[model samples]
Target chain A: MQIIFQIIFSLFAIAALGLVWRRRADGLLSKHSALWWSIIWLAVLALAWYPNSTQVLADILGIGRGVDLVTYCALAFLFFTIFRLTIKIESLQRDITKVVRRDALEKNNI
Target chain B: MIMILVPAHNEAKTIENVVKQLLFVGDKVVVIDDGSTDDTALLAGNAGATVLRHTLNRGQGAALETGHTYARQSNADFVVHFDADGQFDFRDIPRALASMKEKNVDIILGSRFLGKEQKIPWLKRAVILPFARNIDRLFGSVSLSDAHNGFRVMNQRALNFIQLTQDRMAHATEIPQLIRRYNLRYAELPISVSYHEFGQGPIGGFRIVRDLLVGKFM
Candidate 1:
C-alpha cells in the first residue's frame, strides 16, 4: 500500500509539471497558476515521500490522523476546483447570451 | 418611447395575445423568446412585436436582460417588464404608468397582496408568498408586499442601474434586493394576476425556493 501511494504521488507530480509546461507553451499560464501547480504539487510530493511528516503536521493542526488531514486537504482542493469551474461556466453562458441577443436583435431589427 | 418587454419560454400559445395587448398599451412591445422550440418567435414577430430569440433556453431572467439591453440601446424612455402568460390586465398598465408619473418614482411594481381584485390561490398566498416576502426582507432592506409578482415598470434611471445577473426564477428575489441596493424610489400598486395550471401548485413553490437557493452563489 505504501509503495502504491508513493507511485501515485510521483505520477501526480509529473502530471502537474506537464500541465504547467503545456500552459506556459500556450501562453495561458498566469503567475498564480505557475505558483499553485509547482508549489502545491512539490509539497504534495514531499508529503508522499515522507509519510511520517504528515503526522507531525496533523498533530500541530489538532487532526487525529495524517490520512484524515490529507483527506481534508484533498476535499478542500476539489471544492475550490468545482467553484472555479462553475464561475467559468457562468461566464461562458453570459457570453453565449450576448451573442444570441445580438443575433436576435439583428434578425428582428425594424 | 415606452418599451414593453415580455420574456417568454415556449409560450407560443399566449405570446401573440400578450404582445397585442401590450402593444395597445405601450408604444413598442418586444418579446424575448428564450429558446422556445415552438413558434413563439414567429407568432410574436407576426403580431408586430420585435422578437428576440436565444439559441438555448437560458431562463426568464436572461431573456428579460436581453430585452432590457435592446430597450436601453433603442433609447426607450420607460420599460415595462410584462409576463407572456397573459395573467396581468393590460388596462392596469396605463394606471401603473400614471402612478409612476404621479409619485415621481423610478419603479412601479405590481402587488397582488395590496389589491382586493386579485384572487391568489390560498396555498400561494398563505404559504409560498409570505415565505418569499420574508426571504426578500432577509436578503435586502427593501420591504414589498408582493415580492414575486412579475408585473413591473421601470424608468430609464432605474433600468440604467439595475442589471440582472440571475438566469432563472431567482431574478424575482434579486429585483427587490436591487431596489434596496440602489436606493431607488419604488411604489407597489395593487394588480390582479390569474393562477394558471402550470404556474401554480406545490411543485412551482418548491422550484422557486430551489432556484433561489442555487442563485445565492451565482
Candidate 2:
C-alpha cells in the first residue's frame, strides 16, 4: 500500500509540474501563478510521501485521523478553486456585457 | 417624449405585440433582444421598434442598462422600462407620466399591490411578497410597497444617476436602493399585472432570493 501510494504521488507531482510548465509556456498561466501551483504540488507530494506527518498535524489540530485532516485540506482547496473560478466567471460576464452593449449600440447607431 | 425600452429574452411569441402596444402609447420604442435564440429581434424590428441585439444573454438588468445608455445618448425626456411578457397595461402609462410631471418626481415606479385589478398568485403573495419586502426594507433606502415590479418610468436625470450593476433579477432591488443613494425623487403608481401566462414557478421565486443574497455578499 505504501509503495503504491508513493508511486501515485510521484506520478501526480510530475504531472502537475509538467502542467505548470506547459501553462506557463502557453502564456495561459502567469509566472507567479505557475510558481504558486508548483509549490502546492510539491507540498502535496511531500504530504503523500510521509502520511505519518499528516497524523502529527492531525494530533495538533485535534482531528481524529490523518485521513480526516487530508480530506479537510482537499475540501478547502476545492472550495478555494471553486470560489476563484466563480469570481473569474463573474468578471468575464461583466466584460462581456460591456462588449455586447457597445456592439448593440453601434449596430443600431443609438 | 416617452421612449419605451423593452428587454426581451426568448420572448419571440409576444415581442411584436408588446412592441406594438408600447409604440402606440409612447413616442418611440426600443427592444433589447438579449441573445434570443428565436425570432424576437426580427419580430420587434418588424413591429416598428428599433431593435438592439446583445451578442450574448447577459440578463434583463443588463439589457435595460444597454437600452438606457442608448436612451441617454438619444436625449430622451423620459424612458419607460417595460417587460416583454405583455403583462403591463398600456393605459397606465398616461397616469404614470402624468403623476411624474404633477409630483415633480424623476421616476414613477409601477406597483401591482396598489391596485385591486392585479391577480397575484396566493403562493407568491404569501411567500415571495413578504420576503422581498423585508429584503428591500433591510437594504433599500426608498421604501415602497412593491420591490420587484419591472414596470418603471425614469427621466434622463434618474437614468444617469441610477447605475445598475446586477445583470439579473437582483436589479429590481438594486434600482430602489440606487434611487435612495442618488436622492432621486420617486413615486409609486397603481398598475395591474396579469399572471395568466406568467411562467415563473416556485423555483424561480427561490432563485431570486438566492441571487439577491449572493449579490449582496459577492
User: How would you encode candidate 1's per-residue C-alpha lDDT over B1-218 as one tens digit per residue?
Assistant: 99999999888889889888888899999889899999998999999988888878988888998888888889999999898988888998999999999999999999987778666677777887788788778767389888678999999999998788777777888888888899999999998788774364567656666656555666
The number of the candidate with the highest lDDT is 2
> What TM-score does candidate 1 get on C-alpha atoms?
0.87
Model 2: per-residue Cα lDDT over A36-56, one tens digit each: 999989888888778788899
lDDT of 2 at B211: 66
Where is the poorest 10-residue window by lDDT in model 1 chain B?
B197-206
Q: For residues B1-218, write the lDDT of model 2, one tens digit per residue.
A: 78899999999889888888888789999999999999999999999999999989999989999988988889999999898988888878888998999999999999978878567888777777777778777876588988688999998899899777778777888899899898999999999887656455567656666666656646
| Docking quality tier of model 2 | medium
CAPRI-style quality class for the chain A–B interface of candidate 1: acceptable
Q: After TM-score superposition, what is the CA distance of residue A83 in candidate 1 from its true location, in Å?
A: 2.1
C-alpha TM-score for every candidate? 0.87, 0.92
* Candidate 2 positional error at A72, Å: 1.8
The most accurate candidate by TM-score is 2
lDDT of 2 at B66: 94
